[model samples]
Target chain A: MLKVRVIPTLLWKNFGLVKGVGFDSWRRVGPVLPTIKVYNSREVDELILVDITASIEGHIPDHESVSDFSHECFVPLTVGGGIFNLSQITSLLRAGADKVSLNSALFENPGLVNDAAGQFGVQCVIVSIDAHRTERGSYTCFSHSGTRNTNREPLAWAKEMEDRGAGEILLTSVEHDGTMNGYDLELIERVASRVNIPVIASGGAGNYQDMIDAVTKAGAAAVAAASIFHFTEMTPLGAKDAMHEAGIPIRRRFEM
Target chain B: MKVALINYGMGNLGSVRRALEDLGANVIIAEHPLMLLDANRLVLPGVGSFGAGMERLRNGGWIEALYQQVIEHHKPILGICLGMQMLSGLSEENGLHEGLNFIPGKVLRLDKLGCSLRIPHVGWNEVNYREGMGLFNKIPQAMDFYFVHSYAVVVEDPADVSATTSYGTTVTSAISRHNIFGTQFHPEKSSKSGKQILKNFLDYTPC
Candidate 1:
């Protein structure tokens, strides 16, 4: 049986690791290597490395940087940011990422989602949907690092992602960005119910209990947070232990 | 050292490069013929049509050079995804395409399982090992590895199948012969299982 994942999403800038805020204003965190080393020590289930700057730069992930990151990291790594084509996707995978996350590319060329999943594998293709609350009080999907709004309902986009061959949906709440209030449980439940593939809830996580709530009450297959882990509010291990205590079946350190 | 990610102009190459470099191996995007000569190890990674990949290799002059280096020079070479498919003699993908002939077999496309199972079976798949093969090195048994492919190699000899995975039916997941080894699954992108498999291949002693 697949266990719920407690993933720590890392943002990459140039060759260094940075944290993103509302999809902009990247603050240098440290190098991705040391961050991943700590995550590995904590025995995190998996790591999500998103190149928050890729779409802006108009290039695929910096291979030289990712290549450097992979050398030090010991666990499964999922990379996103600027994955535009099958070649770029191939480059990211071959560079040592377990999966490649796509957002703006999917919205720009929906066929890319299916074509990439067809050539690679659905498991290797992660459709990352960044959503922001609309004035209409419905969640609207945003791409290009949440700058461009698709005006499509979040759940509707999620179902489309699945139908288009996305193995999993990394759903991030733009409204919840940097808040750490807890995941958008309502949004998670909405998307989780709509898509068959596992939904990794991203954004607005406050603490370990937040993870439990996201996974249990909200029915998220995985819970991803940035501020808590990025700022060291809670270590990856402590969070995992907390999740375990909360009765979420997590990947044990020994198992890793 | 320069590593060759055989560009038949299709298949996953980036993840393989990332994994190899993550393991501290110097990698090169091998396309032209001369790229294979300078590399300490050769990594032939693939993803799409078997025939197209083979044609790309042959037309690009990598097939001949790779054959000489692996078969004649006995250098360590790893074939991944469609790269693994090219190790066999032939493939049913995109009609019949001649493989590297390092291993005896024909690659066959998996029949779509009824009930929306989907062709090109994608996602985390478990490889059931028949016996201890070093391709898994330090990895534990029956772990889930990432997979994405519609065609798999049908080994002419049963002994060539190193590992198997079940979808609608049992499919060959990994195959090996002498210094030559092939994996239908993308071990580069399989996470820990993938890392362990690559480590195994990198550290594997010739039989």
Candidate 2:
């Protein structure tokens, strides 16, 4: 049985970690290295470290920083933000990133996903989609760290990404981001049902029930949390234990 | 133990190299085939399509050198993920591509095997291997390891399979025959159980 992954997402900006509601990302958390080291022993299945400002500033990923983080990240590390071309992907891979996530670059050139999937295998190419509910009540994809509206619907965009060979999709509902309310179960179910590839549910997780809901109700293969971990006493293990108690197949043993 | 992680212009070598070094084993990131001669054991780590990986290995002149070091010299070698697939005889990914033939087998797509489950089997899954011997010594049976790949090896001989895992189907998760060892999972990225498996590999000695 495949274990449902519990991933701790560290949002990086201006040298430290931050949490924001709906992608504002203004509040300060702490450094990146220590968070990763702690997660290493915390029974989490994977770690996703995204430099929140890299793509918005039109800069490349900080290879040195990623290398340092990955050095300490014993579990599989997925690095995202500011990854545009093949060279950047190569640099990150050599820097120890098992996977790279693309957001803004995918809006500019959707073929980057195809090219990346072609060059570096689809398993390493993860396309991050930030979806916001429009005034009319339909969700539209947002880019530039959830700044600009790409005018593309989440369901259609997710299907296209899957067709383009993206191994996984990091689906985030911007309105629910940092709210600690719960995952956008409707949006997650919409996109996850549309694609055969695994969908990682992100944004709006308040407690262990929220994480379990993302997997049980929303059909997410994995659940990624930020504010719930930073703001509350909730740990990744606690979330996994809750899910495991609910009869969800999750990796409980960190070590022997 | 001297362990050389092969870099054929593919995959990430940092995590594997660091994992070995953390265990107090002398490690080398070998970009050339000649470097394999210096190490007591070779660690072939890669992440990519089967066709592209084999092309690089052949062009880089790694096939012959690997055969000499791992086959003739009997120096134990462990192949990880795509590295494990390349040890097989052929792969059907992006058309049929020939492998190193280190382990006589063919790589086939998991989805094509009537699996309703998603393609590119990603995430942690249990590996059913015999414990307390050779590669899996000290590691618990049916341990979970991280895996990310669409294809798996089907060896001609069933005894070549040292471990197996079920994900809508029985995928060959690990293979061990004589001195050749291959794992479809990423032990370096598999948390503590993986680190223990690597330690066992470092301690492995051929008869």
TM for every model, in the order presented, reads 0.76, 0.93
lDDT of 1 by residue, A49-91 (tens): 9887789789878887777676555556889988888999877
Native RMSD of candidate 1 (Å): 4.7
Question: Model 1 Cα displacement at A54 (Å)?
Answer: 5.7
Docking class of predicted structure 2: medium
Point to the candidate with the largest lDDT.
2
Write down the RMSD of all candidates, one decimal each: 4.7, 2.2
Write model 1 residue lDDT over B1-207, tens digit each, in one string.
Answer: 456666667644655776777767787887677777877778888666788888888888887798889999887788888888889898877666798898898888788222134566665567777667878766666677667677778889999888888777878888887788888877765556677777677677676
**Superposed Cα deviation of residue A217, candidate 2 (Å):** 1.6
Each model's DockQ? Answer: 0.18, 0.64
Worst 10 residues of 2 chain A by lDDT: A247-256
Error of 1 at A79 (Å): 4.6
